[model samples]
Target: MMTEKQLTDALRRRDEAAFRELILRFQPITARVIFKITGDKEETPDLVQEVFVSIWEQVKNFREEASLSTWIYQLSTNKARNHLKWKKLRTGFRLSWQSEQAQPPAGMNHSLNMALEMFERKDDENAITMALQQLPHNQRTAFVLSKSEGLSNPEIAAIMKLSVSSVESLNFRARQNLVKILLPYYNNKKS
Candidate 1:
């Protein structure tokens, strides 16, 4: 039941138990940050592991000026950015992985495929994800942290290394752009 500061101190001293606690406490947030950025569930587990590994090596260098969670977030976001860069260079396109959904029955006709796609499960979430993918990386991250992860502007600013006003601006633009992107989809559904 150690506090985050005590746990960080133990981790700085290279305690295995502290590292384990760190994993248990922070892995989910780290995973979510990377996964939202990359949109790849298959890639997230490995990326989370890599984030912890980097943190393990760098814990001794932590200056404690920021909260431990902030540091972890900064590390996770940086790693995710690097991963996206490397992936884009290798693949020449961003891979937006869809959520796991029920497979269509085999041997469907083209019309049936179109009809089924029109009524697909998770359509709302998927459409929102598509819009999110369309946003620039900073805007997307700022939006997700603000809206999805329920983080405050100051926390997001720390994670993004931006001023709080900049974070606010990013969130503002993200919302406006998302409304523009998703308005047609909702309108189409009503037709």
Candidate 2:
């Protein structure tokens, strides 16, 4: 198997096999990153493809100062953010497209699914989603990166181009905001 550098070199030379190999190598990671940011499984697949297309166009300009994974992560982050912004501008509200189809088996609890269906009927999920959308961009990104993608602070920092300390600070604030917003629901559920 070729190293990342060799693969990148081949891609730069416009080798189709190398491009396919690169897509195979990075698609899952890119998908995860985009999905975490958007919380929209239906949208992630197309967005992941867009990220790779952007990478193909921009690979010649890559400076190699950071690992290729890091570069791709950063690119994925930017694309996801742009997608969110574009969606907001186009729709006049941020539309979430999270489909049950992509949820982890562990997260697909029957009771929770029933509860979510009830909440949907009551439009409560929209409230929670709106509250999450109210969070600051960096805090939202940090929270999603940590919780949804299971990325560590160091990894999020690398992706966001922030210091580790900054990532931690963002996550702390994000959690605080989430707790405040979700407290009523949590209390009701407990009761």
Candidate 3:
């Protein structure tokens, strides 16, 4: 496997194979960051592709101060944030995915999104997913990066351009707000 430096040097040389290698190597983390931020599985694949394209265009600007993964996460997060902003302006970030939708592609589990946590019931999992969407974007991003993506607070802070303390605060508020919003469903599940 080529080291990150070798891959980056290849990328800087405009080597197509190196770009493909970069995509293959980083797509998992890239998808996680994009999907978690956007919270829309249907759009994630396309957004991820767009992220790679964006990366290709901006490879020359990537200073090696951070790991390649960190750079990719930063790019993916910004893309996802921009996509959400455009989506909100277009439709106010409506929750009604079923209202006017196209058929999902084959082999895609439209029922479960990429976060991929197991729940006893699909409904409960989906309910939590919906509640997550209603959170302030900072809190949701922090929570997803910390819990679902298993990134350290410092990593999340770096990706989010916030202080580590701010990331901690966001995580705290995210948990509190999720419980506040979903406590009824959680109680119902218990009983």
Candidate 4:
């Protein structure tokens, strides 16, 4: 197996094999992160491709101050955020958490019950996704990386270009916001 440094060096040199290895290694996590962040299945595949293309184009400029995975995570989060901004602009709709009734994509499984850990049912996943979408971008990113990806606060901070304390704060605020956004939905369901 190639070391990360070897892979990064190869990628910087534009080696096709290194690029393919990078995709094979990172694609699943990248897709999951993008899906969780954007809450859009249809756009995810295209967005993932865009991320790899970006990595290819930008590898030369990578300073290697952080791990390659951390750098990739940062790039993916930025891409997802930009996608949301463009989508909101194109549709002239606010990307608010107060969404109309939405359905979780088909085939949601126990594994996807990452952060909430309580969403055994599809409806619960839908509610979580909607509530997650409602958070501010930094909060949402921090929450997803911490809870869903199980990354550490320091790692998240590196990816987000924020302090560890900031990541913790974002996560705390994200949890608070998710509860506020989801409470009414669960109450209505119980009624």
Ranking by lDDT: 4, 1, 3, 2
Q: Evaluate model 1: give its TM-score.
A: 0.82
Deviating ranges (above 4 Å) for candidate 1: 94-125
Best by lDDT: 4
Candidate 3 per-residue C-alpha lDDT over 53-132 given as tens digits, one digit per residue, 9 for 90 to 100 = 98888889989988878788888888887888788789974422321132333212332332223334455457666667
Q: What is the lDDT of residue 113 in candidate 3?
A: 33
Task: Name the better of 3 and 4 by TM-score.
Answer: 4
lDDT per residue (tens digit) for residues 54-170 in model 4: 999999999999999999998899999999999988998656432222332221222123323434345546777866766667888899999899999999999999999989888
Query: Relative to the unseen true structure, what is the C-alpha lDDT of residue 91 in candidate 2, on a scale of 0 to 100?
Result: 87
Write candidate 1's Cα lDDT for 59-98 as tens digits. 8899999999999989988888788778878988633222
Please give the lDDT score for candidate 1. 0.77
User: Once superposed on the true structure, which residue ranges of model 4 sit more than 4 Å away at CA?
Assistant: 96-125
Superposed by TM-score, candidate 1 places the C-alpha of residue 174 at a distance from the truth, in angstroms, of: 0.7
RMSD of 3: 8.9
lDDT of 2 by residue, 1-191 (tens): 78989988988998989989889898888887787677677999899989999888999999898888889988888988888888878888623324323332332243234444455476645544544554556777788778877889998898898899989988887677566556654666678
* Alpha carbon lDDT at 159, candidate 3: 86
Write down the TM-score of every candidate: 0.82, 0.76, 0.80, 0.84
Candidate 4 local lDDT, residue 150: 97
Q: What is the lDDT of residue 164 in candidate 3?
A: 97
